[model samples]
Structures are given as structure tokens and as C-alpha cells.
Target: MNTLTINQKNKKNAARIAAFALLIMTIFAGLAFGMIHSNLIVMSDPALTLENLMSQSSKFTIEILAWIVIALMDFVVAVAFFYFFKTTNPQLAKLSAALRILYTLFLSVGIYHLIQIAINLDHTVLSTDIMIHLRSFDVLWSRGLIIFGLHLIVTSLLMFQTYKIPKILSALMLIAGLCYFTVHALYWIAPSIETTTQSIENLLALPMTIGELSFGIWLLVRGSRKPFLNATERFGFNA
Candidate 1:
């Protein structure tokens, strides 16, 4: 095979890996959230404490594993895109790649706090636990979500400019990214918004998740040409 063909194959393989990772992580996150939702409905008092909510994750070990896996998957994707962008379009790569890296770092910290929230929920309710450490968990949760929201927006913008993928896909991603921004703003400002907002945001995740999965699958199952191969040919990889 020629060098170009080899590169194409490598990119396809990378896409497959990213798609599988996204699919699995989406499943795990869905299951975990579903359990949390069920618990939320059954519990009395309505204001779920950090500790109480976390307690519902009966399979803490598995949940933790899933979280770690998903975050790592995101990190891998970010790296892959960085390389791809470096080859394809440096300016776009710099923005999305940076956001992905930031998202991964914040997610790592956020997941840690989530686990802490779970353990505490086992012991106490919101009145007691939510206020623990001056609402540190709440702050972390908000910041993490904000960072992630930015990641989605940045990725969506980058994808919009990409050639191989359909523009509609990126458009939806942009919408989802907007949703994240709205929800995060609400979280930061109102801080006591109804659970409905959370539900709404979670719903957006479904599409966003699909977008990522679809992109990955497209790259793997149906090979895509390098978006700007003509341009690359003229400018070379350095471009």
C-alpha cells in the first residue's frame, strides 16, 4: 500500500476505536444515570443531598471503572484529533484539541468528586452533606460541567468546519453545546433550579453522544477522504 493509503487506514482504525469507546461509555453513563433517576423518584423530601444521590450507585466499583474508561476514551479521542488536525488544519485543531484536553482534566476531577458525593450520600442527606466543606462538591460539579460544555461547543465548531462529516451533524452538536451552556449558566447562577433542567441537559447528551459515535463509526466503517487532501497536497503536512 502507498503511504497515503496507509495513513487512511490508520485514521479509519483510530475512528473505529473512538466510536467503540463512545458507544460503550454512553451505555455505561446511561445505565448509571438511569439508576440515579430511579432512586431520585423513590426518595422522599425531594432535595437530594450529595450523599444520598451518590449512595444509589450500588455498584460503585463498576461505576468508577466506567467513569475512568469514558474519560480516558475522551482523552484518546482528543489526542487523535490533535494529530489529525495537526496534519489537516492547525488552527482548528488548536481550539478543539485544547478544549478536549481541558475537558478531560476537569472530568477527572469531577468524577472524583462524584464518587465522594456518592460515598457521603451513603452517610447523610443534603442538609448535612451538601454543605460540607463549604459546598465544595457543588462548586466542582458546576466547574466541571462548564468545562465540558465548552468542550462540546468547541468540538462542534471544529466539526462544522470539517469536510468529511455532514454539516447537519455538527449543527446538532452546536445546539447541544448551547444546551450545555444554558444549563451550566443556570447551575452557576440560580444554583437551585428545578431538577427539570438537569433532565433536559441529560436529554441533550443523547444526541451529543450519537454525534460522536456517528463520526467515529463513519470514519471506521465507511472510509472518508482527508477533508482537505488537495490543499494538503499543495501545502504538504506542515499546512
Candidate 2:
């Protein structure tokens, strides 16, 4: 086989790996955010939230483990995307990967705070400090998501510039990136408008979910092969 064929093979493999990682990420995040953390948190009352957290050390530990898996899988997805798109636009692809990896690093810091809470769960600690650590996770992750938005924007630009992915997919990805950027920016920029920011995010949630998840699904089915096959079918090119 020629070098092009070998590279294509590698790209296909990367797509599959990235697709699988995204799926796993969704599952773990759902369990952590939707079920575990949600049950332990009371968004309106930090003291109550702290009480719930202390009540369930074992479950909280599971949530922490889930988050750790999420972080590692995120790194895998970032590397996989880098490999998958590097040939399309080398510089932008590299920047995209780097941005995501940096976001993952920020996420790691948030997870570290959770670890601190877990380690000191049994100790008699000030409620205020515990609440601060809990809030730190939210603050830090929100900051990381701002960076995550940029990563999506860069990736979407690469998608638009290439025919390997559909134009609609690119548009959705761009919208999702904008959603993340806008919502998170409001979070820190205009704290008093928390409700408004949430509303905007809710309105834009569909695009964001469809954007990233649909592309991941596409990759799983035939993301790389379709482009190469299109060349074979329409252009009568030999592989």
C-alpha cells in the first residue's frame, strides 16, 4: 500500500477511537452530573449542598472516579481529533487539539478540588471552606468550558474548509461553540444575569448537542471512508 493509504487507515482508526471516547464521555458525564452530583448538590443552598455531600461519601467517591475517567477520555478524544484532522489544516488542527488539551487541564484542576473534598469528607471542617471547594469545581469548569468553545470554533472552521464533513455539521458545531462561549462569558462577565445566561444556553442546547454528537456519530459510521469513497465514486479515482 502507498503512504496515502496507510495514512487514511490511521485516520479511520483515530476516528473510531475518538467516536468511542466521546460515547464513553457522555455516559460518565451523565452519571456524574445528572445522577451522582445532582443528587449531592443543592444549587440554591450551599450549606444544604454540603450536608448532602457529606451524607453520601461513597456515592461522591464514585462521582469522583467518573470524573477522572471523563478527564482521561477527554485527553484521548483530543489526541484522536488531532490525528484525524491534522492533514486538513495542520496549524488550525494543532491549535484545536491544544485548546482542548488545555481545557482538559483546567477540568483536572476542578476535579482536584473534588478530591480534596473527598479526602477530608470525614474530618470536621468549616462549612464555608467546604462550600468554597465545591464552588471551585463549578467556577473552574465553567472557565475551562470557555476554552472548550474556542476549540469547537477552530474545529468547525476546519470542517467548513474541508469536504470530508458536511457543511451542516460545520454550522452546528459553530453554533454550539458560540453557545458555550456566550453562556460561559455571561457567567463570569455579568453574574447578575445568571438566569438569562441559563435561558440562552437552554435555547441553544440542541444545536450544541447535535453538533458534537452528530459528528461523533458520523465518525463512528464512516467519517473517513466516505470522503475517500466519494472520490472513488464521483471522480473515478483509484485508491
Name the candidate that leads on lDDT. 2
User: Which candidate achieves the best TM-score against the true structure?
Assistant: 2
lDDT tens digits by residue: candidate 2, 36-128: 998897767867877887788889999999999999998999999888777666799899999999999999999999999888876576667
**Residue 115 of model 1, lDDT score:** 64
Model 1: how far residue 63 lies from native, Å: 2.1
At residue 171, what lDDT does model 1 achieve?
75
The reply for model 2, stretches above 4 Å from the true place, is 227-239
Error of 1 at 65 (Å): 2.3
lDDT, candidate 1, 1-239, per-residue tens = 76555555555555566566666766766655454434443233445534444554566545556677878877877777665444455676677767777777776786776566555554445545434522453466556667666766776776665546667777776776677667877877775774876787777767645656566666556533443332453444423
Error of 2 at 59 (Å): 1.3
Clashing pairs in 1: 49-126, 51-120, 51-121, 52-121, 54-118
lDDT, residue 18, candidate 2: 89
